[model samples]
Target: MNQINNLVRHTRLLEIVGDLIRVRALGVAFGDLAMIENIDGDQSLAKVVNLDRDIVSLQVFAGGKGLSTDAKVIFLGRALDVVYSDNILGRIFRGSGEAIDGGPELPTDPRIPVGGPTVNPVMRVMPSRMIETKVPMIDLFNCLVESQKIPIFSVAGEPFNQLLARIGFQANADVVVFGGMGLIFDDYHFFRTAFENHGVFHRTVMFVNQASDPLVERMLVPDMALAVAEKMAVEGKKRVLVLLTDMTAYADAMKELGVAQELIPAVRGYMGDLYTQLASRYEKACDFKGAGSVTILSVTTMPGDDVTHPVPDNTGYITEGQFYLHNGFIDPFGSLSRLKQHVVGKATREDHSQIMNAMIRFYSGAVEAQKKQAMAFELSPFDEKLLKFGRLFKERFMDIDVSLPVIEALDLCWLTLSECFDPKELLMKQNLIDKYFPKSAHSEAEEGETVAQVA
Candidate 1:
């Protein structure tokens, strides 16, 4: 493409493989948008995916089923972009950035190119603030720090979508951008209804690519959502939380495209660039020094519960940490937040760190005691206490439905411990114990007095 003749058109395609079409053209850069016009003059969008010295391979947004060798390919001389504005809020879009919610169109909204470079380190603020989700397991243990990029690692048959929706509505963010890839109709409907029913739709923007949609569009959903989120954070100075579901589907789309383009495969037939592709999006989560932040929380489901699967395996290396959802609970042992230290004690109450450590310690003990009991070993007095504390731990905090503020959850943690063990046996910090231990745990006199006061 040149300034003198930027509109370049080719009337012949060298090859058409699946959704990919190859054309010989000059001055076309990678990722530049194009239009493929059929003999009937019907046009579909294409993107310059691979450019090997003028043999440009474009992935047709609509599949190549009805296209012919004589179809005209016009280079658009620009990258793929999406519409952005205040009007985009409360609206839903397909992966191609077209409105699918049957709402009014905003043709006048400014468009921003998607899949851009990550924020420069010099422009980023060190993450220090916490985004409270009100879920006891998350708030009390693995705290979600602003600008953090993390994923929920689960498998099929898990309620990861439910957990994601709960966090979307409950999280402390000024704006929400949700992107769903290869979702079935029910999953898409559930998320939409969840946001509407919880009264967050007014501040939310959704980009969905259903299972029946084009595979190329699935790859576009995250980029579009992240672009809108970046706009909201940098321009509007709004704290944005981006929720992406089933990134495995996104990776699968990439794999399918790579296969169509005849690219060499890496692990499990996934393209070798899987890690790079994922990092480019995850690294978009950032906090601007003088502005707001973009925090990403995504779902990556493993096939057959295999952690070594290419998708989750590569994700573990790029993301800060992961929340492992299993058996309908965020597993205390598997879930971790690497950035939680930035806010666990500083942003939260002083006793938060102590409470979190002590609770996990006792829970680990409980697991051991349960195993010993299962083996028919004689239970020690302390084992009995561990068993009881473990039961209360799961009931009070482990359930996905358990919602409580951070402070209240900490208080409940203390109460649960007091009911199971003597105050001296807690082995927590002396200062925290003195300040937070239930008065009834120290003496029956205080308990009776408390009951009398309540009466």
Candidate 2:
């Protein structure tokens, strides 16, 4: 309340629908924060969401409740910014960047502008470093590369939020920044407790928007999360991994606004510019050339688990790749990380590619064998072998609960393969088979161990 309204204040309301307010104003820029003062001297915050000649439309962050047409509106003269500091780590903030955990305000002036321009391509370095999450489905199969933008595609009942929490603790990054939109109190508490119990809260910052918050603020969570991450990577010189959950909710927020504006619907009732709106946030993923990097891992839940849903469909176009979560596991055949080859063989072991291919091939074979059995066909010796390999693969590697370093998992992979078939049955190089086939090896642990050790 002590903050000064150091600019001209307008007392007019062109329209008031939902949380949006349109007023007569001049020289108001997009994304600028505005203060709406009620007749009772109570103030609420809003952000300039649109502008047309002399009329500026603002999204009231605190919702458009108890305001009159005569309420005073003051523009803050600058784009929306979230306070930046190392002190934000381990703290929980609301969608508007206010600390919601009863913590003291993070001190001022270096505010990071939300939804800033994407880092220039000329300044970006090729994303080559692998970001290991100690999850076999990720580090071992489709490796997550530093500065990569990827999403977890899952249905509503799937445990995607749990997977995000696992990555928060297991990902090899200097800091973790989480943005949760439209989450219920239980989901919010789950993330907090998981991070705290895992002892990674000290290096994480959470920006959350609960389901009961106004839809407009839900739209700001990604921007706030990314802005804070940009500050941390560029200024603090840290490798930052940003995790956003349920981007489908964010898209729904935009769709609500579009409906309120009486705009024609595009794909599945989403805005026609949905792709552009999503790309603006996802393209923010950057390697930052020489300073540091900002990597993104987000969840995009599909309606009815349909990949054709507009949100996940558009997301696939902007992100590098996606992880498909199904049946309590990241489906190995469905998930992909496009940048994995940049480091899988170069940064990882020489046999990394061979081992990866062989396991999937064997798993695919196992699936076929199970199908044959379903049809009541007589099983052959080779079919039985594949059936056994398939079962072990899911148990040892595909389960989300299975957490092991890349090398440790690889060693176990060889153990799994060896237990299933003869050396020639693997169809691997005889030289590699001779050198690394567990029995002739000095120690299987030492072989797979050094490949991804530095990741």
lDDT of 2 by residue, 265-381 (tens): 998899999999999999888998668899999999999989999999999999999999999999998899999999997877878899999999999999999999999999999
lDDT of 1 at 322: 97
On a 0 to 1 TM-score scale, where does candidate 2 land against the true structure?
0.94
TM-scores for every candidate against the unseen true structure: 0.95, 0.94
Residue 237 alpha-carbon offset, candidate 1, angstroms? 0.8
Output the lDDT of residue 272, model 2.
97
Where does candidate 1 have its weakest 10-residue lDDT segment? 1-10
Compute the lDDT of residue 180 as modeled in candidate 2: 97
Global CA lDDT of candidate 2, please? 0.89
Query: Cα deviation in Å at residue 173, candidate 1?
Result: 0.5
State the lDDT of candidate 1 residue by residue for 231-284, as single tens digits: 899999999999999899999999999888889999999999999999999999
